[model samples]
Target: MTLTTDTPYALSAPPASLSEPLEGSLKVDIALVGAGFSGAIAALMLARRGVSVALIEAAEVGHGGSGRNHGQCIPVFGYLDEKTLPPEGFVLLRDSGRKVFKTIEELGIACEPVQKGWLNAAHDAAGLERARAAHAKYAGLGKAGAFLGPDEVEALSGVRGYLGGWVHRDGGHLNPLAYVRGLAGAAQAAGAALHVRTPLTAISRQGGRWLLKTPRGDISARAVGLTVNAYGDAAIPPRLRRSLVPMRSYAIASAPLKPDQRRAVLPGGVNFSDTRRDPMFFRVDESGRIITGGLVELRRGRLGGPTVAQAGRRLARLYPELEGLGFTHHWSGMVGISARQRPAIFEINEGLWALAGYSGRGVPTTMALGRALAATLVDRAEGARLWPHDAPGRIPAAALIGFGVQSLRGPLNKLRDRV
Candidate 1:
């Protein structure tokens, strides 16, 4: 058991690893590492196309950030066209991402999928104006989004502290784990072999084929896809690893609230995010429990781990109607983020490809990337339109700079609350 990358967060609770390494060298048309949405969807699509596929997971399916994190299925790409992205580039990203949400409905993978959309609430006048600016951009592109004022925001969200916001009509919410598992199950049903808990020790290409050395043994494949997002094990290039900085995010699910409390918080049950750089994003589950999350506490350090009662208390402060509601579950997990705040898809080598860096908008974005990568592999089809090619390049100082920026996020968030 030689060590590899020092990725924190062990398998919190395990049902046992479902994987055994390659006892004998086996060959396949494509090998996908990671059983999350991106890898699973691509594996399923390729296998269905009669391509031999092998799906590998370092841990159990959905054990990483995929299964963790808040289950908001909102479809807005996190990046904007301001200083970070060009106008044409944002149009491409926004339009393509819009199509990705459309595909989810077409696939019918059902995980309580909703398309009623969400709001990006403004905490101040300046934020409200920015929301309007975003609204204009989406409107120019003919996307079904617009600005809403304080009255409309209050009417919709039932929250007190909001100046206005933008509404994305096509965005929605879903169960993250269930959808990920569905993708994995689809791949298996389509004749792909899945190996879980078989951590890859190293990967190297030989004879135009990639060899994945795992704990149990080795497997060879003509092509490979790396879908492990934030939990960067050293199995990949340092450059690619630097593209995504892992950050710990926390969430708390309260015990089923009384009917009135539920009505008070999530009036119409539309998902919601805020203008805060590290905004508190939350929604009510079907079980009538409030699921809320935000930036990591300054005292909690960078690696978000087992949460404490303090998180629940903070949640209570935001929506005081639910004070003393008694939180049933509290936990945290890491999410992969790109400095450009957009996802990237690139060819790593001759036949090896990588698709990751969703910047915390992993739900719909993952589905979108999965379909595009699958199409790119199967027949050089056009699903590559899911993400624009000329998107912003990685910021050189992204790794260390991101850490420094996020380190101050907690305190800055506290300041925003006062504003």
Candidate 2:
């Protein structure tokens, strides 16, 4: 089966409906913006609890970053320092991967779920030291992580690396789009109404409820959850939009590798990303294709031909056995980032909530956050404390700041990798 699309997840995703957009006025207990992972998961969890939920999406389900990501279910925050996470945050992050798998199994989602370990390879001695410290810190917290020696790293990931790194056993990979679609199906089955191609243009308070004006209709919700992430600029409140800097990320999938070629690479079928500043991540798909991605320049919101070619070169360099392997798919998506480098979950109003800035850890992190958000809305005090309920402070000239950061990231990463 083909593995590439403008949104690749649709290729193998179980058949799902486009869902008619909302028309006229409707009222619900909760109206979720963005039918991506976060919103879909929240809808499913809340509906399962008998809450009336309406999930509105500008585009079809999984069309955003949910369908475009690398699909690794990392157990830790990508951009946050381990020391920065509180004890409770550490526990949440530690079990986030398992939570994702558990949810999938409970829902009986058909998405391929793999539980092989995740390899964080160290490119240099300094990287090795950081990895060692990370492993030790997690171990101190009674988390499941271990530092791999050079030999162990090589055995787990069939590539030449200077030093060893850490492995999170609970971490794994999945088809992100398929998973999101599965969640959407589950939410709908649980009595949640899903409206696709229905972008929210405004959110205003109406008496005791929030009125969400959509292109096709308006939804009056007792509680609203904005989970649009990078696409929230026009659809969400200005304060929340100003706090996020959207960054474009790119990925490519090579033609299925020969059996010998696959064995020469990720023989253990574990997902991997190196410790470089501009780290590259790769994992073998069920079809034996090597899927990899990293930071790349975007033209008109998409990766240009040159950037895709550069990704192929980078992949070949990482695994010499895959040199000259032609890529069968190239795609790009936007990820919302915060200056703080961690996700933000806070109240937009008294009852309206918003969550964003998973950085690049959306796979498992979003799942965990979604569940927490659902619980919070349901008045579950335990879930209310899953993440801090404080506003992510505004960044000055967020658009300009995002542009500057993206422009410098590639070059700076290259320089850091050399050091």
| Global lDDT of model 2 | 0.79
Off by over 4 Å in 1: 1-23, 78-110, 300-319, 378-402, 416-419
lDDT of 2 at 218: 96
Q: Encode model 2's per-residue lDDT on 105-220: one tens digit a residue.
A: 99888778898878888888788788787777656655555567888888888877548877777789988888888889889998999999888888899899999998778999
Q: Summarize candidate 1's per-residue lDDT along 88-142 as a digit string, tens digits.
A: 4445455544554565565555555555668888987777777777777666656
Question: Which one is best on TM-score?
Answer: 2
How many collisions per candidate? Answer: 0, 0
Residue 408 lDDT, candidate 1, scale 0-100: 81
